[model samples]
Target: MASHRRPTHSGLTHSARVTVLSAAAATAVAALGATPAGADPQTSPERARAAVDRLFQEAEKATERFNSASERATHLREELGQVQDGVARGQERINRLREALGSLAGAQYRSGGVDPTLSLLLSSDPDTFLAQAEMLNMVTERQHSALQDLQRAQRSIGQLRTEAARDLSDLERSRAAVARHKRTVERKLAQAQRLLNSLPSEERGAFDRASRSGRGVLPAVSGDAPASSRAAAAIRAARSAVGRPYVWGANGPSGFDCSGLVQWSYAQAGVGLPRTSQAQRYAGRQVPLSEARPGDLVTYRNDASHIGMYMGNGQVVHAPYPGASVRYDPVRMMPISAVTRV
Candidate 1:
């Protein structure tokens, strides 16, 4: 009867195979049950690094917004001050015009309500009175001019007052935005610090050492420095700040962000650059990376959140990130969006 044919495969009977499979499944379940804690070793560190990077990126975006709002508020304050001054001057001119008009009315009343010109024509000293009449004619012309000026000043004062009010309103809104951005940055940075603190001591040490290592040093000035005086000066200035701390919105000898470093370095060269990376990207003539010269700003990331000053020889000086200082990195540290010659 074909041995009631329980087929055999791999030299095992069907019953034997079934038993083996059951035992294997049970063993797998047991092994899974006995699995140790933290079986996957890579997850925590990877997640921590990714979280830190994400938080830092968010903080940077908020920092830029804060910087922009701060700059706008400053400009608005200056403009409002000028407008208020103009309004004060307009009021003064209006008062002067009123006083002149009053003087003219008083002279007419003193002339017995008759025309001053008629008084001049009937005077005994006719030639002398004629000279005085000429003077009076000049005064009359001046008074008419003052009246027109007064009307114009009044209109100007109205417009200036309106502008001043609008500027104040805008400034208040900008201040609110700045505050919001500041809060966002602080929260993100705090979260990042917490994530970083969670990293193992060895991993944290490695990360810190990496930041302090290779690329953070100043780049050597190559012989290929651009011939442009301003560009060379800017490059020199940027290089001089290689070890400065990174401070959001600072354009200074103390600390700087990416665009702040660029702006401040250019300022040292007597060149004016825009405040933010986005604006600075368009502030100068854009050039191809291959054609980039010393002092050209190399903007990174599609959003233009990062920038660095080209220091010739394929190196750039940049304020890399929060924990990193102003340093030299390869021009290809990140994706290059633009190279602008300021």
Candidate 2:
């Protein structure tokens, strides 16, 4: 401290460093002050419409998935019931055979408790009993036949129970899938509703009016017969439900999903089709788009989640979406996947 020692060669003391940092901080503060205040945060109408459209499309896809899973669950439940019923009948048949075998054993015991017939009846292994009976001629032909029937019944019961278990498992999985789709659809619809609500009041009213207008009127139906009798009948049936509501997972007289509409219409025509749009796409012969007739099934998008009945003049009658009725629209509304002549 007493010495007049020169500063370090670098010549940057602590005070100088602090001065430089202060200058930098001031510059940053000025830059921050230059930014605009009160910038607009609201979404534009066009942007909002696009977002809503996307959400509705997503909801429709999920609705189709829900419908398909619900249908599969129904079919699986019926099959499980049938298999379980078969198992029950087989068990009853086995009980009858056991009773018959017991009666035979009691009759043999009255004569002599050590007879071959009684021994065969008491054998624990059905296969071994049959084998021994064959080699030793220990049982009558009728008894041999009875043992074969018992073995058959046991095998049938085992197979049926196995099948029923599999169906039950499949049904559970389908139910889960249905529930998941339902949640997806609900989330999408809620988002869409929020977007719609965010719109200006006048725009919201316009949207509501546009959605409801001309919805009750049925489009003109083609009078000519379809490519086939079944197709014609299906088209007629679909025409009958043109004004019905679009209800997800419904396949009936009141309302329908896209694939449900096709499935229900085809069922009315005495032709059974698969429940999902993707499955229904391959349920019949594929026809060229130009060759599509009034009754053909029109699938849309690459995934084929949406379907409709072809009405002549380039129109398709379909359960369009959640808010839309079963209305007629141009076939070119979306990209076509296939035209199935169902």
The best candidate in terms of lDDT = 2
- Candidate 2 wrong stretches, greater than 4 Å: 1-43, 112-145, 213-225
Give the range where candidate 2 is weakest over 10 consecutive residues by summed lDDT.
Answer: 1-10
Question: Which residue pairs show collisions in model 1?
Answer: none
Name model 1 segments beyond 4 Å from true. 1-41, 110-142
lDDT of 2 by residue, 1-342 (tens): 000011222344545433433333233223333212432223233344445566777887898788788888989999998998999999999999988877766766786767776787999999998897885564566567778888988998999989988999999999999999999999988877766665545555555554444355666656655888888789889888887887877887899988889999989999989888999999989999988888998898899878888888778888876665777777777889999987
TM-score of each: 0.79, 0.75
Give a tens-digit lDDT track for model 1, residues 226-271.
7489998888888888878878768888999777898899899999
Assess the local accuracy of residue 263 in candidate 2 as a C-alpha lDDT between 0 and 100.
Answer: 91
lDDT of 2: 0.74
lDDT of each candidate versus the true structure = 0.74, 0.74
